[model samples]
Target: MKKTTFILPILVIAVVAALSAVFIVDEREKALVLRFGRVVAVQEQPGLAFKVPLIDEVVTYDDRILSLEVGPLEVTPEDDRRLVVDAFARYRITDLRQFREAVGASGIPGAENRLDKIMRAQTREVLGSVSSNDILSSDRAALMLRIRNGAISEASGFGIEVIDVRLKRTDLPQANLDATFARMRAEREREAADEIARGEEAAQRVRAQADRTEVELVSEAEREAEVIRGEADAERNAIFAEAYGRDPEFFEFYRSLTAYARSMQDGNSSMVLSPDSEFFNYLKSSTGGVSTR
Candidate 1:
């Protein structure tokens, strides 16, 4: 029993030592071996890694891409329009040694904090240089690209590579929303009014043209009727002249009879004339004496 206890303790100690001397790194991670607070070796590949037991430390970092979210930060664009912007960034640690050196004991958290500052600064700088319309437009891919480039350049010192930066949301402040809506409403109202005025102007032009056409038609018809009446009068006078040239006596008798019929149309019609006047010529017979009726 005494020998078994002594050998069992030694075996347990050896197993513990062996377990502490090595570690298994996942494929998604990179391990750094530090001895006495100094980096002694770096394991970028996966699988088993060796280290001195109780004398060395292993730090693992993610080798895949990581994401960082930036603020709903307020920015004033070139047009002096203020906007609230929400953004995010995608980054990866490129050099693990440089990363450790740059971030020191704080590790990923320290690197992220610094990266957040860089992203915020770049976001403000790039967005502020342009107009709010540009930021709110669908073509804002260029602006996002500019922010990413600036962030990548600044973050390089910390062994970070910024893949992309995107603005998730951009909007006017609650205080400005009502004002912008009112302005848009007024603009639409003005445009509607302009369209109505143009329609009325076109209607007036059409109405004036119709009125002119109506007047011209009436005047032309009156002119044509006057021409027809004048032609009729001329033809009747020519017929009268031809009848008078054919027979003077009959024409004179017919004229006298027509005058007598017109004068005696009313039963009470009377005339004052000398009997010897030629007005009684029709009453005289073929002889020189007066004829009884």
Candidate 2:
């Protein structure tokens, strides 16, 4: 019984020791084994891991890609125009040993602080070298790539891999907003005025053309009427000549009668002439002094 008690205690102690030495590393996590604050081993893969229970410490960090947001940082561009910029980054811990050494006990939080600095510096350096227009334009993708490249080089020293960097937003500073809006409004108003002026000029041109067409049409109609009137007068004169040629004496008598009728049409009209005037011939002689055939 004594021997069995001793063996039971030894087995229990061994089991306790084994349980304390073993740990699990999840697929989403990376672990570092530190002995007396010195990194002894790195477990990047998911599986079982072992460590000295009392003397060694295990620190775990997320293995997945991490995200960091930089500031609404103010930067001045080459044009001396200031802009407010917000940016974000994707990164991961590529070397666990170096990361632990670099960050020490601060872990991910410390690494992030340093990473943020690196990103901010690169952002200002790359974006500041270009004009604000370029930073705000679609060409900003190229600038972002430059920032990412710069950050990657700097971050590599601490075992952090910068996957990507992007500008979330770029805007004119609050102080510049009113000025910019005023300038935009002025430009729009100028354009509107130009459009209205052009429309007026075009309307004037159309109206002038219409007026000229009206004058031409009226002038042409008047000329045509005059031509018709002249033709009609010529035709009447020709008819009178033909009648006179047929009978000269009768035509004279008819002309005298026409003149007498016209002169006596108004009761108030009076004309003083010699009694032997030719106008009175029709009144003096019924056949105009020509004997009937």
Candidate 3:
């Protein structure tokens, strides 16, 4: 019983010692074993690891790529246009030892801060070389490529690998936005005025053409009417000439009777005339002979 009691304490001590030396790491993590607070070895696999009890330490770091949103930065392009640019970056610890040596285990935030500064500087450098129109147009992709490449180049010494850099948004300043809108409105108004002027010119031309057509139509109708009246008068004269040629004496007598009827219609007429006057003779003539009636 005494041996068992002594062995129990030894077992407890051994278990405690074992617990102190044991290190557990996940698949997506890497651990650095430190002796006297100095890095001695790096363990990268998922399993149990060993360390000196009470004298060694283990510091674990995430091995996967981390996302860092660097937030928004105000920038001005070459055209003197100001905008706010929001961006994000994906990075990973390529060299764990260097990462631990350069930035302590609790220094990821500092490294991120440094990376943010570098990215902002590079973004400003690249973007400052382009105009606002280019940034908003077909050169956006090229600008982003240049910025990413520049950031990768600058981040090489910081023990971090820049996997990707992306621009989230680019916003124009409020004052500039109002100016742009006003310019657009003025352009639109000018275009509209030009169109209206063109339309009025077209309408005037159409009206002139219509007036010319109306004048031509009226002149043609007047000429045709005059021709028709002249033809009718000529036809009447020809018929009268034909009738006069058929009977000369009868026509003369009929014209004398028509003149007498018109002159005698006023019953109060008094005329100085001789009995043998031709005008009285025609009136006195009756039947087929000339006689006083």
Ranking by lDDT: 2, 1, 3
Clash counts per candidate, in order, are 0, 0, 0
Give model 1's clash tally: 0
Which residue pairs of candidate 2 clash? Answer: none
- The lDDT per prediction is 0.90, 0.91, 0.84
lDDT per residue as tens, model 1, 1-293: 99998999999999999999989999999989999888899999899999999999999999999999897888899999999999999999898888999999999899999999998898889989999999999889999999999999889998889998889999998789889999999999999999999999999999999999999999999999999999998998898899888876677778888887787786855789898888778777574232232
In the range 166-261, model 2's lDDT, one tens digit per residue, is 899999998798899999999999999999999999999999999999999999999999999999999999999998998888888788777777
Q: What is the lDDT for 238 in model 3?
A: 88
lDDT of candidate model 1 versus the reference: 0.90
Whole-structure CA lDDT of model 2 = 0.91
Model 3 stretches astray by more than 4 angstroms: 35-37, 139-142, 240-293
Question: Which parts of model 2 have CA positions greater than 4 angstroms off?
Answer: 1-13, 137-142, 174-182, 241-293
Question: How well does each candidate superpose onto the true structure, as a TM-score?
Answer: 0.65, 0.73, 0.74
Better of 1 and 2 by TM-score: 2
- Relative to the unseen true structure, what is the C-alpha lDDT of residue 287 in candidate 1, on a scale of 0 to 100? 40
Rank all candidate structures by their TM-score, best first, as comma-separated numbers: 3, 2, 1
| Candidate 1 wrong stretches, greater than 4 Å | 34-41, 54-57, 97-110, 130-146, 167-178, 226-293
- Looking at candidate 2, the ten consecutive residues that score lowest on lDDT are 282-291
